[model samples]
Target: MVSEEADSWGLGEGGSRSWPTSKPERVDDQVTVLNEHRRLSLQEIDNARFSWIHAKICFVAGAGFFADAYDIFAISIIVSMLGYVYGNEDGNLSPWQSTGLKVATPIGNLIGQLVFGSLADIFGRKRVYGAELVLMVTATFGQALAGHGRAVNIVDVLVLWRFVMGIGCGGDYPQSAILMSEFAPIRTRGRLMTAVFSCQGWGQLVAGLVGLITVSAYKGAIRDASYPAIYPVDCIWRIIVGFGCIPGLIAFYFRYTIPETPRFTMDIQRNIAQATRDINNILSARRHTVAKGLSSDTLVMAPRASLADFIKHFSEWNNLKVLVGTAYSWFALDIPFYSLTLNSSAILTYSNFGKIDGNSPNDVYESLFRICSGNLVLTVAGFLPGFWVSFCLIDSWGRKTIQFMGFIVLTVLFMIMGFAYVPLNSTGPGQHAFIFLYCLANFFQNFGPNTTTFIVPGEAFPTRYRSTAYGISAACGKIGAVVAQFALGHTLLNSNKDMQIVLEVLSFVMFTGILSTQLIPETNQKALEYLSNESQEAYITGAIERGVPLYA
Candidate 1:
């Protein structure tokens, strides 16, 4: 049997010889540990008879994604309503003003992501998670009560409030993804993470539904020229924005009760006693058998790592490469993803599917309905498949390969939309065909880069720095969001007939994405924990062998 000191040093010690010590031996030990960990993780999953706890955590975190999607999209709905309130009596607003309101929130989103994301890493996920919820609620409610005049000049106030809310929303992306990933079992990691991530689709869908409801409420007022009745238009929009708060409140209340991750506790908190109990409980609950030699008191744990130590751990070249690759992929995904959503109303306005104030009765409602219909279809198609793909193939196919496929397809789709739009065919099958291609692009985004970009930041980092690393990566992504939001409105889709111009801009951006993706290595099958002492040594040494810079 292994002695206390031998076990203290782990499998490499005790000089058992057969237990693994050299590099090859260390690889063998990793296989053994991986096999054991995989089994234990699976057993724990089966035992979590309170699987609903897992589901609840997922839902709570996911609600934030939904809110982010909804809040961002609301900018478009409100802009559409604004056209009716303060445009030509015939009901059309200038494109520049329309674009400004639509894009301002994304700018806010970028700032929020960077500021709050870093906080999640420095503090704990639970604390920041709760605070962000309160911020989101306050800002959204603020938007609801902005002003009522025909030319209500609260644009600055609305923009600032949205920006504040965005910081909270931006905070949600990393916090939720990291939180869900930690709670998930390895085998089901993809499923749980993707499921939570897919909440964005639900949020978008809710936005579409809300748009439909809002439009329906105004249909009567809009149709009757004489009555000119007010339809809680501002309140309706407020309620939609305010709706995001309910889920956040629920998440905040429950998040306090949920324990920090056992892996996090093991890696960062160094509370081995509690970590061991949680780990064993997770395993025994699933397998219906006690751990053979494990006891809470007997379990040895690593010391809590300091921030300096954490940075020191990743001072190697390859580590930095992986970090850069992951961050770039995230940045690449956001440019088009956010640009499309933030500018979707402008796209619809130019598409001319219907008019806001044409001669026809209920024309605005019809136009709003069509946009919502398209969004609903796209969300269901892309997000639902994402959950399955991430669940079944993430480990098997690997992260880099899956993301590569996504980027490549996205590139091709963008090119298709670009070519279809170049001539700017105003009327006929060409325009309709262009619209179809645009919808297809949205579909591919959901199935491909959208899911993978978010997934990688969570999977790539160790638990101790998971939130911090994710925040950094997510902040980079929001930088892209800010650029897309502001630029697309000013340059890409600035004109009513520039649909093709917008497509070309995104196509150019997506090509760069395909190239940036080449930097990432495959990581699907690798276990998240430390492999072995020799392997850890090798990780440090291998980088030096290749002349990779070490930070510390």
Candidate 2:
């Protein structure tokens, strides 16, 4: 049956065809056969039953996100401690210094997304997966060691090291998302992707908890009559930042040990034997069945991807439009997401959870506790629950609908908070009300765009370009993060009506995201091939030639 199907599409005997020395003279016939074989091979993955391999993939992939979030968010706690230790008598960071500290990692993230994303496409995902973790582990230790010397300023050292660490965090975004997406079955793809991404919430939650515990543990030391106030607080930040390395180290060996994705083997390398062997090995251990019909003898190789090929492939309007939509929507979503998230300490201060006026050691400890406690509250109440909600509903609700709903709700919440900032900030009860709305906003973000944006780009593109497209989309989001940290954050801090204006602007940004969401097609429960125009065209052509109905 397989041979007959191959022969009908003009594939040579045993489905092993010679590589043409030049561009195919008959593009349609060649493309149809290749896509058909790819469709069948990938479908096996899509239809496969739930197994331990899927769970293993999710854990290995999710560890990266957990580390990324922990590293990124630990700074929020560290920043507050920095103000206590290094701030001028006023106990505040210089606006310029704060901006640099906040924006540095995002700049590195942008570069990493572009560089590592393309590298994964060219060198293969397995080859590139764990390299980032090594950078992360090294840079994390470097961040802890910062400020140990009197000659170098702590903030400068931290900014430099965190920027390097950010590159590793950035690389994980595409590497994990594409890796899990390629391995997941279609029925659970959204849930599996969300499972990996949901670790981000825990990372944030753990960051807050760690900050709370670390500072509390040193509370007695801060109150000691002999030690300087700066001494105990300085150690707090280092411990929090250094703790990020644990998850990365735990995940590194597993990530490195995993085989290259089966899709990459079949679709890019065109090595059916290796792809089949890998798939069957996974199945034998986890599914009690093995892949059948793939020849173990042939080693067919697809043309290597190049800069020109990338341009030619994406030059088509259909391909370009999806890329633009994913990129722009992610960019739109991250503007407010990162701006608010990265600066949650300031928001908590504004909400009156911590003391803004304190120079004494006892006062510093009290302030640190309050801030860390507030962050923990927000994480537990808002961030973690939001992620789990999305994890539960993303597959059922569909990515587009959930994203649209999230953006719209976020728009309304931001507008309310923006327009009502003065009244809300004025009274204790009003502030509590404000925090509730803020938590709801966080919930919608996770249940909405945050989870969907990551999942969609991972699944929407063809396997050959999946990581590259995810990288571009993620890179654009980081650009938004950079703009938020540097541009909007700076403006909000400088402006007289800081909270009001920031919230209003973020509301407007969310509204624009709704418009961008329209460009992306619904992807829930669909085959990856159906999402790619090139593959879909070939699949349909081959189906018709074989007298199979279009639906089949």
Candidate 3:
């Protein structure tokens, strides 16, 4: 019998020591070894202080996300620039072309999330991490160089590349979240992971700055040209997008070198000895066996990951609910998020919050500058602050409470903006108030479900399924994003009435997210194993009575 206190993961106590006899017996030895193993693995992770390795991991993981955000959101501005250079008489892309550009990446993300997520679990995080970044970098640069061959229009070429980029972006979600969550101490896990996700704000901010800079750099040429300012405008979009790959390229080497998480090694690979040494390296000065008095390494026949095991584990409502909760919550949140976020330029103009006049060369400069300025204001005043505030309070206020509060507040804000659209935008003062509410909505989106959706799935599952489940959850969110991009293309860009309808619909969507939030457990300051709701005592069954050890 395993001891009740064998591991702090809620296993029951009381056991008798039985080493490998001529006939091997029960798991007192297995409990001791497994417990010590966890002390070195899970406990060390839960209790370890923040270190430089953690900082390095944060940058390596966050850099890819930064690139992801820059790529995705920059499209709104990119579309505007593309229209200026490539549009018909009015200097705007047709609705079909615009929708194609917006929708391709999320579709790609859906595929990447499912595929890369499982690949990471089946193969390994370290093996799968950098590949996505490479794909993203290649696709991003490819878009810049893409041309309008008669066989394939430049818009189609860009869309295809964007889809490829989306896959890479999708892969980063699970990889970064799983890696950051698994490696962090339970105490600081929420904050650290938020720190990585918060990079999205910085990415968005940088995209805006890049847009503003590129357009301004071509001001002289544009001022003297025709309405579309074809050559200068063409240069502007390419420069902004091509620059996205720089952040990813800078971090590629470090991502390639990042250590595989200990949980994956111990739980998935079933390698106790090597897992122990990994912890030892992380804690070189404080190295000592927590197993008290055990000598010689013994092979532990831990639970293995198999298809049957996966079905059996998630088949249970307890585990399935967490998955359901995470997926649906993310799905509901993204409906409004992706709709308004990616089409900010359109929404801003419709709300009269952003100023844009015509297709004239002078108008082009002003339009680009104002759109970037609007995005920057939203990022700095709303998105950035919301992320850091969540970082500070996520552990203390608890994930569930913050999620509930965020959804509720956003619901109210969206209704106010949606239902009162005419009155809110009727005057300069009214429009200013509308923009303030817009900023508030962005703030709560980050401080609330956005951060938690990314954080919870990574923490709530067992090691074997963590990345895969997170990917499923993230994919569900992208589905909503795909829907939103379609909405952004077809409806939200049209008129105030359409914007009003979408915002009203999104308020209800935010409310639905609150209900879904009920499905997930509060994962504050709990060991990942404890949150997994699995029995741990017999996790490592008995010493190697037969086959050779995986790591001796």
Candidate 4:
């Protein structure tokens, strides 16, 4: 019967060679059959060559990240413009309002990661993927239209819309990472994941460029003596915020069209027929002839995952330790990472790198331009290169070593910048020195913990719980971001007296991240099944008992 079904499907004699001739008569045989099917499905994915389909997957996943980065980082620039239009005597965002604006998205992000991450695992990746992008597009437009009416305060409206946008952004993190990781061939899985994440650098760059262009375009209006310094009240910042929706819109179609990853379809959903069809479609699209020739009737659904199952799987000390390591390392990394990246303009301004000469409209415009320009230079010099370096070396040098080095180096840089805060901010040469350290810190962030933290969670967990574990780890990181933005950013970094203290604390945080790195096992040049000891043991034992070759 199996041979006939395989023949009818054009699989021929070779295709049915290993398929069981009858239903498994015993419990262990049943388990072995199901495990072998899953193992083969994953091995197929891991060994497949790179193709245009892979590129499509990367772009579809990457576009969400681009939008995420643009929306999150654009706020920093917009805040500067807001201060110009609605400046009090201080002519800057008050620490309280700044904290609210910065922290709202992360709060929303925490909820999104928890909700959507679990949903992806339960409902399947394709079903839950594009909805977040839609939410983001709507919220981004709302943010642009915010403050148009007099009834609500502008900051409150922004806080509301941005918080919702943050949810969408948060969803993208797990969805994109897992989708790309699942689709990627093992030989370049790390690089592929890194490639998708590298979109963040582009988004950061675009944010700065948009700020510079919009502010520059409106410079003439600001320079008009007849008009007040804030004459074009809604023009500049609205344009900047509104521009973020473009990438999401462009990527929406592709994201919606992307098929469910074969691994998810087979391993989690336990639908071998559909999984095989999807894989064949991908191969056909890529002009490859290999097909799994799996029969839907012969394949049985795995038990649906539940909370109890989740607990049972992760309760083991080894699995629990991985979760802990990923969560805490991300937390420690983001404290300094978010605080620095989100507030780069403020830092530069505080350092007098782009000081405003006067309260004139022209002066304000130029200062915004200079600040944007400074950010662009730093992002281009340090941020983009770091991602590319990781892209090149992630699969070769391995994740653990790079992450450890990054934490160590970043710790030293922060400590130096912290203790020498007075000197670094004083003379011209000192300012230059401080800027170099800051840029270098940004470099190591992408080259090390920032990129690795995001990648590790997606790879380390089993498919049934991959999205959920990734989400939990990510949410923990956002918790760190919230603390940094609200707790440390608002309180300590707000005033000059406490700036050094903030840096010193961040240095300590990075060092602690170094300790957490010890918990992560190296995953270089290994298949996903081999990453976790349980999965590796199952694959090895199953292969031996069934008299089949591993990776076959």
Best prediction by TM-score = 3
lDDT of 2 by residue, 30-62 (tens): 444445555445656776777888898899988
Candidate 4 residue-wise lDDT, 1-552, digit = tens = 112322332222224334333445564664565555555555567667798888998998888899999999888778777776665654576777777888888988988898899999999999999988988999999988876347767888888998999999899889999998888876788999999999999999999999888877887887874434775635888898999999999999998788888878776766665676677778433322222333453334344579997888889989899999999999999899888888887788777866375767677777888888988988998899999999999998889999999999999999999999998888999989989999999999999999999999988888888899999999999999999987677764366657788889899999999999999878665666566545332332222112332222
Residue 151 displacement in candidate 2 (angstroms): 4.0
lDDT of 1 at 20: 17
Residue 473, candidate 2: how far off, in angstroms? 0.3
Model 3: colliding residue pairs: 3-12, 3-13, 3-14, 4-12, 4-13, 4-14
Per-candidate TM vs. native?
0.80, 0.89, 0.93, 0.90
Off by over 4 Å in 2: 1-37, 148-150, 225-228, 284-304, 494-496, 536-552
RMSD of each: 8.0, 6.9, 4.1, 6.5
Model 2 residue 299 distance off true place after TM-score fit, in angstroms: 4.4
Tell me the lDDT of candidate 2.
0.80
Name the Cα RMSD for model 4: 6.5
Residue 241 of model 1 has an lDDT of 69
lDDT per residue for candidate 1 within 296-334, as digits (tens), equals 332222333467766775687566666777788778888
| Per-residue lDDT of 94 in model 2 | 81
- Misplaced by over 4 Å in model 4 are 1-34, 148-150, 225-227, 284-303, 355-357, 535-552
Q: After superposition, which runs of candidate 1 have C-alpha atoms over 4 Å from their true positions?
A: 1-50, 87-96, 148-152, 225-232, 280-283, 286-314, 354-363, 380-392, 422-427, 530-552
Clashing pairs in 1: 47-285, 47-286, 112-167
- Top-lDDT candidate index: 3
